[model samples]
Target: MERYFKRKTQPEILEPSPKSPKNNESSSKQTCVDSMEINSETLQYDPGLCTPILSYHPNVRDQVRRAYLQNKPCQPKTHAFPYTNFGTKPRRFNPAWFTQFPNWLEYSTSQDAAYCLCCYLFKPDIGDQSGGDTFVGVGFKNWKCKKKLEIHVGRPNSSHNSAWRNCEALLNQKQHIETVISKQTDQDRIDYRTRLGASVGVSRILLQQGLPFRGHDESENSLNQGNFLEILRWLRHSNEGIKAVTLENAPENLKLTSPDIQNDISSSISYEIISAITSDINDSLFSILVDESRDKSSKEQMAIVLRFVDKGHVIERFVGIEHVVDTKASSLKLAIDDFFSRHGLSISKLHGQGYDGVSNMQALVAVAKKNSEIGDLFTMVSSVVNIVVASSKRRDILREKHTHVVLEALENNELSSGQGFGDHKRFIAGIAKEGSRYCECNELGQYMQRMRESGWESLFDEVSSFCDKNRIKIPSMDDSFTSGERPNRKAHPITNVHRYRVDLFTDVIDKQLTELNDRFTEKNTKLLLCVACLSPINSFFAFDKEKLMRLAQFYPSDFSEHDLELLKEQLENYIWDMTSNSEFVDLKGISDLAQKMVGTKKDHTYPLVYLLLTLALILPVATASVERVFSAMNIVKNTLRNRMGDLWMNDCLVAYIEKDIFNSIEDEAIMQWFQNMKTRRGQLF
Candidate 1:
């Protein structure tokens, strides 16, 4: 090697020369000498400063000479023979015996053999042992050892020695695939794969790794195994759920999750997280923010969202969504209470309960329990039947009417003389039509029917004797069967037998009524005041007297004094002034915007308008979240869509979206927010 140095072209300058004029001869001589010296100096060449030719330096040269004597190279160097005195001739394939069939060039003796650098470095000598049948390829268990058995997960197959040795290999491959997917730039790369009904570029991963196959056991849930698809799922959710899907831990033999693998993973992991989070939460007291939502099917689905102090302020994680068959306040409260209990939590520990607008079901629940025949009991029983009615299976149970007939027949005796004397049929008919179910109580209906038959003459006597013994008196009432004249002029004969009805149907109407009032009309001045004491909140907040007086003009009543007083209280005190709220301010301005922007008028504030506005404020914030999730399911994880159960869908959504996530993940979420990667290397930048 040779080395030299030179400063890139730079100009030199002239300087005054020092001289003495002592003697003409000496001065002339000195002047000529000075001029000549000055001329020599002008060249200003310094061999010592020729950038030192670092290689030419005395100290370096001696060391270099010594090293050369020893036939050594500096820092790092490579030696190669320049030319060979003689070269051997190459052997040729014989065409005589080969027949020169295709007249093609000779074939190479090498196959496309490449080494997995990562495996070679971390697990040397593992190839020949694991190359399945030969040293040409790697087997599944070459690197696994007996001592590693405890730490290494094996196949369910008990053949301990045959258990896959390449778990680390598989895990490493998964890491690389995730890295590649993370580098993808196309926002819909996942969606594209999903639409084509192809794997999430998983096969590409195997191909990139030069692995012949992914080796998935169809019998074992692929999701359970750390397959590339699962990894892509993890990437999708992790990127969406967490801030990033990173390979920061991959090189360290650590893998993160599919954002919400919490939904599908082992309880041990969830428990560990809960314990970690709980141990860190202040006072070990977990604060909760719970609300209920409905699916497309409208099952009273309760979302158990949690808020607790993590490393910093309160973080709200949607723990999970629980589907409740009943939406009645008590039932809902009970369900929430039970959930808290199960999580080692308590209701009293509950700091807040967030729900949608308090309409019928909740308002009545918020109120005190009412008289058996009045608001409370009616609200309770009616809500029960409404729950049954809401379900298709249970709805069939009450349609038969066997249960309702028996109930109204038995209750007919309880009415005061003339009070509801002719309403038994109406009551039974009412029970028959509503959404309800009495399937479990069919035995009770049969017992009542037997009493109605002519053969059961002594049934009423036995009932009267038991009522006397139990100190329970049936209602005093005229014969409901004879309340009016029939064409035969005959009264219902056995109808006078002080009868009884099942407790279920007897309670459904008032509940629905209470719910209607609470949900639709509770905030209506007159209507709310009407059920003040009957409300779950009771008469705590006072309604404005002047407001009540103003609203009273809307109604016309020829009523009793007690009823009027009750009406006055409800009409005045049940006020939650939302008409002028901020949400409504936008509603008010919509009319103006329409006239200006699109030329329209906003008139009627139908109940639907209010409902939509309330939904916009509350409900959509909860359920509209499905838009993005369903989008992802269609695009990234469609393979599981139809197979998804209602409960599972909730889990998927929870993983797919975070808190206040609906509005956050608009169409722009895919384009503007996350950048998908094409490889782990892209992530390095």
Candidate 2:
């Protein structure tokens, strides 16, 4: 590389120089001769006078000290000073200038010029009236005009003195700008973290409550700042640490309470809740309850719930809802399967399924009564109830007579009053017409036995007593049984009321019993019997190994012969173990047994037994909870929010129904989870 020197500009004269005076006196007045022409390349400026170096250097102190120590007196040989041409005259540097000052003067041997040592070493780059490259860049070597060098040093507080102070400060190195800014940056990061933490704390509360995040007006003048912003403001006002670094103190773009951030917090909270439930379920058997209905948009939606044993209690949790394209059974099944898979649930672990029936059976029963013979029987039973309990007078008389009968029966030891049978007026008004009460074969059989043992004579006497007391008619043995005409277009035979009693009442009761038995067939009977083996009450005697083995035979698709054998052995051992253990002895129901077993860590001991218990326990007659979810749906997805998305609806439902779990979550923990999801401007926790 070639090195080049910055060319210095020379002062220009307005006119040509005057011709040298011819007089000897004029020539004697000038201390130097006129200039002569010389090549510019041969002239060299002092290297030390080029510029004062201010860039960072570890050895700057040594370099400055060396320059000061090397300052020698410049009594250079007069002839050795190079002569350079400025214009027409030639000016030669006179180096015989050491007589004026001895301590601060510096002479460059190469340039044959003199410089001010103090100004060259310590002059600062800033400020006006600097050396202007004279004492520094181009040396001041005009020996005939020596006063210029004295003026270049200037006053004590001049730019030269300031540069001297800077040089002294630079020697310490610790006062550098980079080090100062680095410390400030760390403190800035800490303050930013504190500000972000306050914002995250507010987000958790709003999400857990299912409250809206944004307000209509969030400006400084607004009184209400919405849930997210308002809560943060409240936190700032109440907490000293948060107040110092939040709200206006925080950066605008990094408020950390945007809708996206709120959603992330809510989603993380939901994940934690599901994780807890998942752990509770573990690999245990569970049941499903599903109810499919249409939303406001007429789209089919299936609300699903899980019924399982958690700890010692049977808990039912709302899992989620699924949107189905169609209402067909296959479509619903596919939706359920997909929903389970997404949540890491297995249908193979399902022990039972509960469904909400499509329509109210009472309306269906009314419609069917017009065409079926069983309907005729039901109509007769309804008519009997109407006749007995129609008027206030007849109702009072029936109650009085019922009370008398009950007192007499009790006194004679013919009947014993129980909890539900204590009040005659509280009797089921339409007992014969209710299918549930009538199908209870044991109760029906007991009723039939009482009627037979008491005979029709007592019934007749009682009716005669009521009729005679009320001044009503007493039909004889040959009276017509009906006041209306029969189907055959002839006047029917007038069989006596006694014969009517034997015919109409007997046929109705017998037909009802027969129909009920037919409906409750061997399939249902065996199923109920098998389910009985899982009962934990009555000394757990219902847990018969033989009955359970027979029940396992029905589900060939699920249980093979080997499985059945294993189940039978498990059942025998379970019965013996439960009957012997003090913990199992007092268990009152299957749920109680399940809970006790889990508490004692005995569930794993008899996996098949507990599975059977789960199956039996979930065969509840009603899916009222599933129906209740639909009822809640009508309120949640009202006219205003009818168009809400499926995921949003599910989230709302979860938050609403499982509020206890949501409330149990700690505020700090929720904020921590939200912050972990992504990096944000603010620090939360």
Best by lDDT: 2
Candidate lDDT values, in order: 0.33, 0.58
In TM-score terms, which candidate is top?
A: 2
After TM-score superposition, the amount by which residue 80's alpha carbon in candidate 2 deviates from its true location, in angstroms, is 99
lDDT per residue, candidate 2, 1-685, as tens digits?
A: 2357554222221111233111233223222211222111111123332223322132333343332322222233322345667666677655445565554565554455666555555654453364565665456667556667656656877765665565444333235453344443556667766665665556556544555567777888999877788888777778887777677776677555666655665555665565466567876667888878888777788888888766646677776677788778898886775455335464556777766633333333444454445577888999989997778898899899989977887898766676344554345433412221112344444576567546577878888988985699887867655546445656555567645565554554555555546645777667776666666677886667777777667667457778888887887787788888887776656667777888888889987777666665555333356776776666656665677667656655565566677677665565555544433444322
The 10-residue segment with the lowest total lDDT in model 2: 36-45
Candidate 2 local lDDT, residue 316:
78
lDDT of 2: 0.58
* Cα TM-score per model: 0.22, 0.50
Q: lDDT of candidate 1?
A: 0.33
